[model samples]
Target: MIPLIEARGLVRIYEIRKGPFSRPQPVRAVDDLSLSVMPGETVGIVGESGSGKSTLGRMLLGIDRAQAGEVIFDGRQMPPLHSQQWRALRAKMQLVYQDPLAALDRRLTISAQIGEPLDIHGIGSKEERKERVRELMGAVGLRPDQAGRYPHELSGGQRQRAVIARALAARPSLLICDEPVSALDVSIQAQVVNMLRDLQEQNGIAMVFISHDLKVVRNIADRVAVMYLGKIVEEGSSDTIFQFPRHPYTKALVSSVPVPGKRLQGRVILQGEPPNPAARPSGCAFHPRCPLATDICRTRTPELRRIETGRTAACHLLANDLAVAA
Candidate 1:
């Protein structure tokens, strides 16, 4: 089956200048990364900050142009950014940001904000838009009377629900949610996550859910992709990746998740900060902190390859260890 969204060898770079007289240095925010999201499938992207998860999300939505590679949505290559074709295609793709308050217009009523997309996309008549907005409010668990409330009138969770309602107004086939529930309280986070799962199942929306929270990802994602230094170090079924991670970076990340009633023992605590993207390490970016790093890991970059059925990892040591085990 053709993927609803496909990203191939996507690369994004930024030039940072140290000083007025210094030449700008190019930083690869997103390295050559490829991923596919099937219809109604939720793919979780988890990593530490600056791992390019947000950048990857933007690239997938065609909001950020890649320095290299192409994104194909629903089998056709994505149109040029901000072009007429792209604008038309935007209705089928939407983004839910971390800060709902920031995403929403402070001056506009929740109803108006949710209906804005319908108006912008020319989806329905004015009366039809109003009715749709009403339905949306109800769908997201907002009361009819709350429609007139401004962003500040609502609580954090309500604000996020309003944002989700707006994103879904156009019925997007693919949704890229970057840290969607990160700002909410634990109880509210569970509510929003459950709502998202329900919405995906009901609308059959394929989602690229990016977050640093492994527990949440494990709860909502069909598959999980672990990224390190702008590259996907490991990817597999959510259960498989969480239960038996193949890559060292993935192991460290999974181990860091605190389990209830279980004391932290043998947890892999990585040393040192992530290397500067502008001056990435020679070979494996994680080698400097990896306990299993060998001379090969220090000298040659390992390619992401199949480590087992339905699982892949980019680590030389893992491949060698798996081979020896076999």
Candidate 2:
């Protein structure tokens, strides 16, 4: 089957002005990257902070404009912002942010927040909207009476549910979840994650799940994409990527996951931090910190290539030999 969402050579750059008179410097939050999600599949994007996961997620949802490349949804290229087609396309794509409380209006009641989309699109009458809002609340596992309560009146989990309910109100075919449960308590996080999974199963909604927690990703994602320095370094089936990571960065990330009663061997933490986008390192962006870095890796960037069936990694060491230094 064709993919529900496809991002090709996606690039998103932000301009930072050092001074009022200084020239604006471009920060490549998301570099030339591409990925896709089949219908009803969950693709997890995992990375460290500042790895551009969130930016990529935002660009995928049409919340942030890409500087270049294409974002195709259901086989149609999303038009540029301010265009009628763009508005229409966004109606089928929605986003669930990290902080539910912050995303919601403090003063607006839960009913008002979830029903806002129905009102915007004129989906139904006042009576119908109210009924839909109640259903939405129940869908997210909240009581119908909670509708009249303000955001502050609800617990953290309830607030997150409200946000999810709002997103579902659009009946979107694709959902971008940007650390949707990171802010909640552990027990609450499980509840939210299970709820999201159940909803996806029932609605057949394709999702791009972005988070720093690999453990969480393992629980929900069918496939996984590991990103570094604004680019996807490795991607494959979640089971393969988690069990037999080929990329050095992927191995290091996997090593960092704590196992019960057993101490993990030396970690692959690179020496220096990620380079600033304005001055990205020459050749492979990860070469500087890669323990397996060779002369070729220093000056030549490796294109993403399939190492095994359904698994791809961008690494010089993996090209000529299967033995990757990690």
| Each model's lDDT | 0.91, 0.88
- In candidate 1, what are the lDDT values of residues 1-326, reduced to their tens digit? 89999999999999999999999999998999999999999999999998899999999989899989999999999999999999999999999999999999999999999999998999988889999999999888899999999999999999999999999999999989999999999999999999999988999999999999999999999999998889999999998788887787877787878888978777777778865788888889889988778898888999998888989999897777544221
Q: Indicate the worst ten consecutive residues by lDDT in candidate 1.
A: 317-326
* lDDT string, candidate 2, 60-158, tens digits: 877788888888889988787768777777767889999988999998998999999888777888998888888889999999778799999999999
Error of 2 at 276 (Å): 3.2
Q: In model 1, how large is the Cα lDDT of residue 305?
A: 89
Against the true structure, candidate 1 has what lDDT? 0.91
Model 1 stretches astray by more than 4 angstroms: 321-326
